[model samples]
Target: MRAAAATTFTVPAELSAAEPPEVRGVPRDGVRLLVARGHGPLRHTTFRNLPSALRRGDLVVVNTSDTEPAAVDGHRPDAPAADAPPVTLHVSGPAPDELFVVELRTPDGRRVLDGRAGESIRLPGGVVATLMAGHPDPRVSTGSRLWRARIAVAGGLRAWLAEVGRPIRYSYLRGDWPLDAYRTVFATPGPEFASAEMPSAARPFTPEVLAGLRRRGVGVAELVLHTGVSSLEAGEVPLPERYRVPTATADLVNATRAAGGRVVAVGTTVTRALETVADPGGLVRPGAGWTHLVLGPDRPARVVDGLVTGWHEPTASHLLLLEAVAGTALVGRAYAAAVDRGYLWHEFGDSCLLLPIRTVHRAE
Candidate 1:
């Protein structure tokens, strides 16, 4: 599937956030927020002021799929360490036939497109990942950005990750951080449940921010979308992802929209999950399954009225989702203003609140 036209602006190097806001002597909620209300001009503020952006009856849905330490270093055991350079494997998730969708990257974060099937990567704690085939299509063996691999580890992959793996990060990010730094306040506690990368929109939402939202009478809803690797090559559509929208969340969304209040999704993940379970009339139902939904100008959001999201790469599919919730004009304007004002980019960067004048109007 081809992507509809969305924002395709360039982000400057200085605007890319390289580390957590805490490392920069700023609280997570202190990151800048760009407000793009359809009827009004763009306004800039801090993330801590998010609650005031919406009305009292508004419902904010958040993704609880926590970030996992999925990046692990491995090398082929058959070759000498000198001959076989260690490859960093970013595990997406378990695939069919007990295989896992994995991307092998060099230490410098460059995609290793040369991964071949039958290659065994020896990892710490007796974990060995064997590449089975190229992902999406097993027939295409070479030049695949992602590979279908099987991991044989003690206990399980989740448990093994806790001990040795780090969060998957791109080269724009500087240095390594503990797994804790990659998690959001809404991330479910414990080890078994996690997303390959952080559900970054909620990263700046601290406990204090939650308290503020509650105090303002805004409802917080929950969902889970175990996201895969977000660094897909430009023009590559996102693969199917597992998501769950609970009965309570669906009920709240319907109630809020029915009463003329907005349902604000915390991120593109939330938007996708909610839209997947929503009916043509904008009513949502509880459901859990893999979603291949691609929101864009052609398939705009059906239930969500507003969005609280992070900056996305110009070519990234998430931008298409943004264009679905907010109109293309508003999204393009917001991104232009963000770039002009030097707002940060990436998971660790700033946030944007997109409130389109009208969100849902089913085709006649």
Candidate 2:
């Protein structure tokens, strides 16, 4: 059985979903889902069938991080060319001492790798984003990207972002989608808390799915993990992001597991948060703050028994986390089947549910 962490395959450009399912004449939960379990034949179904797929006693955990308008146009004040393209500044998240983890993107959506320290980019409303040193450390080579920058606006930063910022867009996504299209049903609605990018694995969930889960007796819980920009260089560990796991949810997780009910995480974000506060012997504790945990073969999942997630890029570091949560062989087979079956990729794409053949829990 080949491990997914070591297995690599090409995802065709045609399979990348250019827009939301609604724009493509499909419902939010109408996207395809491929279910993978231990050495069994893969099951093909739509995302809305999720409640019927799992047992009644199983608990579904979701991330409550809201999507932020992180993208804003800026240009270097010292640029020599008069017709130079606008530099797209992506506000990643907060760093120490009021600094923010930011990235400069070219007009075509490529990372600006040649950014030097002390460079200032002019923003709308006379705001200025001054680039500081490389984020985390100067030694971490992120394709020579990401900086701790200071963006000063007229009012507060939050007020300025809501006024001028838009959702971060990628070259793969064709349309300039509105911020609402990037949000998940479970995202927290407060302006004080926001994810630089959507916790997109949960994007397929709709009100219909929620009602079905309730009818089927599946319990739901929530935590928050405000994500940073998700572009990761090969072999680059993901940067630290803010997260909060509540005591109520933690207690519920332990209770569910003790009764032999599966603890299913809705996305990699929730899995990371749950695993961050989990103790040895698979007990979950409530906690809040930044999490630096990176799940790989070295540290497999101890709490989550199943995962619902989106199809990831071939080189994405998130693939390793899937291997850690649901044995590598399961992930490999699922990805292989997804590619062969024309499953779409990215935030606007289809999804997968990884369950490495757990014992069945009888309905209560």
Candidate lDDT (C-alpha), each = 0.88, 0.88
- Model 1 scores a C-alpha lDDT of 0.88
Those runs of model 2 whose alpha carbons end farther than 4 Å from true positions after fitting are 1-4, 80-85, 138-143, 191-193, 358-364
TM agreement with the true structure for every prediction: 0.96, 0.95
Q: C-alpha displacement of 284 in model 1, angstroms?
A: 0.3
Per-residue CA lDDT of model 1 for 193-312, tens digit only, reads 469999999999988999999999999999998899998777777788999898988888888887778899999899999999988788799999889888776677889899999999
Predicted candidate 2 versus true structure: per-residue lDDT over 1-364, tens digit per residue: 1234665789999999999999999998999999887766899999999998888888999998899999999787665647555899999888988888998898789988878788888888889898877877866543457898887766688788999999998999987988899999997777554799999999999999999999999999999999999987777888898888999999999889888899999999999999999886788999999999989888899889999999998878898899898887788889999999999999999999998866544323
Error (Å) of candidate 2 at residue 77 is: 2.5
Q: Judge candidate 2 against the unseen true structure and give its global Cα lDDT, from 0 to 1.
A: 0.88
Instruction: TM-score for candidate 2, please give it.
Output: 0.95
For residue 125, give model 1's deviation from the true position in Å: 2.6
Best prediction by TM-score: 1
